[model samples]
Target: MAEILNLVGSKIRDYRKAKGLSQDQLAELCGFHFSYIGGVERGERNISLENLAKIAETLKVEPKVFFDFNHSFVQPPSDKKEAALQEVLTLLQAKELRHIQMTKKLLMEIFKTFPRQ
Candidate 1:
């Protein structure tokens, strides 16, 4: 599906950026054109398995890594603020899950002090 392709492309872009490789550089490493790499990163190309394998090998990651989509990353925000909020929520979910219930209770009590909208 297009959505999965987009997700995979986005992850590839993220990893590529994190590894400090330019599209042209990645393309050279994978024996492809810079334009092709660009298209892949932008989700415009439905990458073939052979090419994907080459890319994975060039990137020093497993082929399966490209398809390892996490539920939290299923969708991305178009807005910067929403993206930041999502990242904060992800961190909180990972680090403060047990404290969430207490936080929710405190928020509910605080809300009671305010007039209904």
Candidate 2:
């Protein structure tokens, strides 16, 4: 049950970031408290189905996206590199245009440690 909560929380966080919404913004859209939204993202809250539906709608993703467990890429990252990369992606997706240069610099630093594909 805890694992499920964590997975659901991660999916919610990913979709929320992808849509460029802060927890406060998402909470506003779902008529929930910002702290509740933060708890949901942290896997500390067991969301009711009604609230889940509201979240799905607010994130512009189907509820099923949260339960799709086949992709290891979407699962909790198993290593530090994957975790760091995921965080970078989330930030890049969520932040405004003014952050692009900083994001690019971060990306360049990360990629410097790897060979070009």
Candidate 3:
């Protein structure tokens, strides 16, 4: 049960960050206190399903997305580049289609600015 709480909390944190929202901002949108948001993200609170649904609605994600923990079992990255890539992929998870497309375009533009090796 604790593991499930932690997994759900971690997923909520990931989705929250992906939406470019601060804890204060998300809490405000969900009509919750910032400390409550922190507690939820830290797995210190066992969130109610109704509250969880409110959070999901605020984050523009489906509630079930938080429980899709299969990807959380990934092995540690072997190098810095791999670690960074993994972080990027994690941030991309559960993001809206338009936002993902915007991110891809931004990445492409940023990469073009890099000098040839």
Q: lDDT of all the models against the reference?
A: 0.80, 0.84, 0.88
- Alpha-carbon TM-score of each model against the true structure: 0.60, 0.61, 0.61
Worst 10 residues of 2 by lDDT: 69-78
lDDT of 1 at 108: 93
Steric collisions counted per model: 0, 0, 0
Ranking by TM-score: 3, 2, 1
Clashes of 1: 0
Q: For residue 11, give model 3's deviation from the true position in Å.
A: 0.2
Candidate 3 residue-wise lDDT, 1-117, digit = tens: 888888899999988887788999999999998789999988899999999999999987779988987676344456899999989988887698899999999999999999988
Off by over 4 Å in 3: 72-117
For residues 1-117, write the lDDT of model 1, one tens digit per residue.
888788888878876776779999999998898799889888899999999989888877777868877533324455899889787676567556668777678879999999999
Best lDDT goes to which candidate? 3
Runs of candidate 2 exceeding 4 Å displacement: 72-117
For candidate 1, give the lDDT: 0.80
In candidate 2, clashing pairs total 0
- Sort by lDDT, top down from the best: 3, 2, 1
